[model samples]
Target: MKNVVSYLFLLFILGACSSTKEKTGTSQAEAIEQQTIRKIDVHAHYRYARPYLSSFFQDWIMQAVLVDVAKEDSTGINRSWKQYVDMDIENPGVFYLCSSLVGVGIDDPDFATKNIERLKNEIATGAKMVKVWKNFGMVTKDGSGQFIQIDDARLQPVWDFLKENGIPVMAHIGEPVQAWRPLDNPMNPHYEYYKNNPQYHAFAHPEIPSYETIIAARDRWIAANPDLPILCAHMGSMSHNVDMVAERLDKYPNMMVEPAARFGDLASQNSDKVKAFFVKYQDRIMFGTDFGNYDPAVDWTAEQLDAEQKDLDATYNDLWRYLSTTDSLVIRKQHTRGLGLPREVLEKVYFQNASNFLGLE
Candidate 1:
């Protein structure tokens, strides 16, 4: 009787476990049917100096599941190139890298050949795109001390190589338009940033190309490379004016824009207008956070890093909330309602567009 009772008890336990597994499986299937996971941040900055760890930013990588890491040119920052490559290698499905190359040798007679070979190596080793920074028109100067704009003829070959090889270019061509305005200007979203980083303050420099000039050069390059895909990062630096961005989107079919570090600009706009812009150009937009572990200017402590990480996550959630619901919310001291984007539009802006742009689909 004791043996029989023990056997019955084991059977009952097994039956209960089986029943729970069946219920869980059914619930999972129902959840999958209701919503599919589709999210990608196409313009993240994961590259850092040698002593790199993902202590704070790891949740983003895991939650977003797919992040495109843009390896910005270290030029004066002393970033570790190997760190980016290693991260991509170690986190195969999680990270896609867009490597950067400086313009130190645009005037070099062998600039085209040397850089083309180097670009080929980067591509061969899993680079999906190449990044070009604002140094061309902002700070870099020719032998005559004249700023070499993006349309400089000497850099044609580099563009041609990227075009011929079908590699995309990620262009961070200019500072925000507010960077050119007076620091005291209240409307300038970047007022605080420029005030803190005077080196990047266009008002302080005075000699750098005007905001219009920088934008013109960038547009000229877009026209020149009609076949190559270009990602105009930070909403092509026209986040303050969605109409201007819309005009460019209508003009350049080969170009796409990513909203990285420009959420404040979007949130400040009329929510209805912002929703319309996203709806109209859902296919041309990609989501990006510009989140990274290092900023050479700041001597970051672990505590600071933790705080930044939490803030970044919170801001990202706010962005999602803005798109996913119609609730009114305050962002950056402004009262604005949510865009209430549809699920299809959200899928494209969040994931599909990135997959198509990055060739990851």
Candidate 2:
């Protein structure tokens, strides 16, 4: 009886040890998998450096490009530019800078010269790319008060300079096609934006150039500057239809695009078609969330930071699910199926392509 009791005790001890080993092995495997899932957000606007933000990037094994827009307010633009530069310095390998030249004085005779100097200075300070915002075509006006289109002759020198310097341009020249349509459709991803900012709502302002006109100008610019690498931010503002985007991609070898804020538009489309699009143009597309406005200057409370982190976590998970699985999911309130992209394609889209574009290791 004593021998049998000792035998039972030995078996219990062995079983417990095996269970511990299995749990530990499972945990190590999970950690390794997470370490391998690296990503790069090619378009973002994180203007301020926060410890939590850095922690979030490290937690996800992700990197980002802090893009600046040359808006009407030079003071705000300068502040944001300085903040982005500081953020890049403070968070090496995690944050990259995409600098923009001021579009406020395009009509000035020394516009190109002055802006080129500014860009040169920014590049010396670690700017990897330049952003040309919608103000180039829609908001900026000339000496005669005529809206300046993107392909304006006066902008050629700047484009030439970027091309010569081997700096890629992140061009956001127009709004989505929905910006020209009525805001009655809640399904449209841009409905809320057009509703809130009526100044950019082309539907009400017929005098504004049409969508077709702006897109044509952009196409012309791309064609003219064949050597310049262009990352068309926000699906080149043609997010409503992947087919339109593909047409341009097929035509322009130097042009690439990031989905950014257009994931909702893609989600609204047929899943099979979207998946096919990704596979076909796997080398040309990149992942970008258009996530922004993380200003450290704002005295955010602990609750606000926590809420923001939670929201970011949810958004990243949703985006990952949409890209990497076939499970049915609701994105931006629209029920849709995931693309179920192959892992290799995901790697290129999520990391490699952007890294190659920005010349990062």
Model 2 TM: 0.88
The regions of model 2 sitting more than 4 angstroms off are 1-35, 73-79, 294-298
The C-alpha stretches of model 1 lying farther than 4 A from their native spots are 1-35, 48-80, 185-187, 295-309
Candidate 1 lDDT tens digits, 1-361: 9999999999999997677445333244423422463667777666543232343334433322222332224454333456677776665566676777666656679977998998898788777888777776787777777887888888888889888888888888888888887788655567677778787788788998899999999999999889989988899989888999999999999989988878778888988899999999999998887766556526778787666655665566666666766666766556678787888888888888878877876
TM-score of each: 0.80, 0.88
lDDT of 1: 0.74
What lDDT, from 0 to 1, does candidate 2 have? 0.85
- CA lDDT of 187 in candidate 1? 50
